[model samples]
Target: MDEKTLTISVEPLEDVKRRMLASLRGAADATARHTFASAELMSRTLTPARWNILEAMTGAGEIGIRELARRLGRDVKAVHTDMAALVTAGLVERTAAGKYLFPYDRVRVHFEFGAPAMAA
Candidate 1:
């Protein structure tokens, strides 16, 4: 199976603009990217609980919510809540039978911080 990755980043507005223009010109790659204006936003959306859910679901095939909660040793209600957020974020998908799953075999989060430029 191909090892798909999810890259998370704090992208500046200019970078977003450039990517938008590239996509408009049909020059953007097919890779999936999740960007946030700030790292705090990313952390809030992709919480540790949600990350655990994603880790358990990755490449695990379709699984019912109860089964997933059992595997994660978490409450069904909590898992369901996390799954809902993940689904909304486009990180998790629901199968035809209403099972939840993550299609990717791998996840790689990318976060970077650069020093502010010195005065010219």
Candidate 2:
């Protein structure tokens, strides 16, 4: 067998350290941020392909419809269909690379609405 062994220890915090820990431990954690209602950034207004395009753009940070289709395992026509919708919605931006720019912060409203969020 090819293997290695390692050990680790845990430390318990004291008063001031505990206070700092509390500050770091936010009341609104991942659960709150990712809630269906709160985390529902993509608009239902999008067509299915548009949704796909949006997801691809926001997750992959700008790529052409052909490449997007390649990643999506779909046809270029299909990907473009969605891209058209996404562009109309202003959720995805076309670039010189025939790619897209997500512009997530531009569309985010505290809860990240109207644009597809990072991969779930």
Candidate 3:
């Protein structure tokens, strides 16, 4: 089985329009891509603590809140709250067994700042 991956990026509105047009023209497949208008917005949502949670969960298999907290040396309540945010973001899911898991086996984050001249 292939490991599913989530791509995170910071892009402008024009890039979004370009991609939409390409998809409409049948020149590209409309794959799911998560984007934020700026890196600051992305960082705000994916905080350092949450990033650690995700790192610990990816490919680690389903894990109960207590166990996940133990692995991170964090409080279960805190982990639970972070888990909820991740779930809402569609980055993680809860199992019937009361475990949380990052559905994707891998995650890719991409960001680039064009030259200052192009920033205009």
Best of the candidates, TM-score: 1
**Candidate 2: stretches off by over 4 Å:** 1-44, 105-120
lDDT of 1 at 72: 87
Q: Give one digit per residue, the lDDT tens place, for model 3 in 31-75.
A: 447778899888988999999999999788898999999999999
The sequence of per-residue lDDT tens digits that candidate 2 reaches over residues 1-120 is: 322211111222353356457668873322211112222233444546665555555535557667778988899897777777666655556788766776442122233225657796
> lDDT (CA) for every model shown?
0.83, 0.51, 0.85
TM-score for all models, in order of appearance: 0.82, 0.45, 0.78
Instruction: Tell me the TM-score of model 2.
Output: 0.45
Ordering by TM-score: 1, 3, 2
Which stretches in model 3 have alpha-carbon errors above 4 Å?
A: 24-32, 117-120
TM-score between candidate 1 and the true structure: 0.82
Q: What residue runs in model 1 are displaced by over 4 Å at the alpha carbon?
A: 117-120
For all predictions, the C-alpha RMSD in Å is 2.2, 15.2, 2.8
lDDT of 1: 0.83
How much RMSD separates candidate 3 from the native structure?
Answer: 2.8
Backbone collision tally, model 2: 2
Quick one: ranking by lDDT, best first?
A: 3, 1, 2
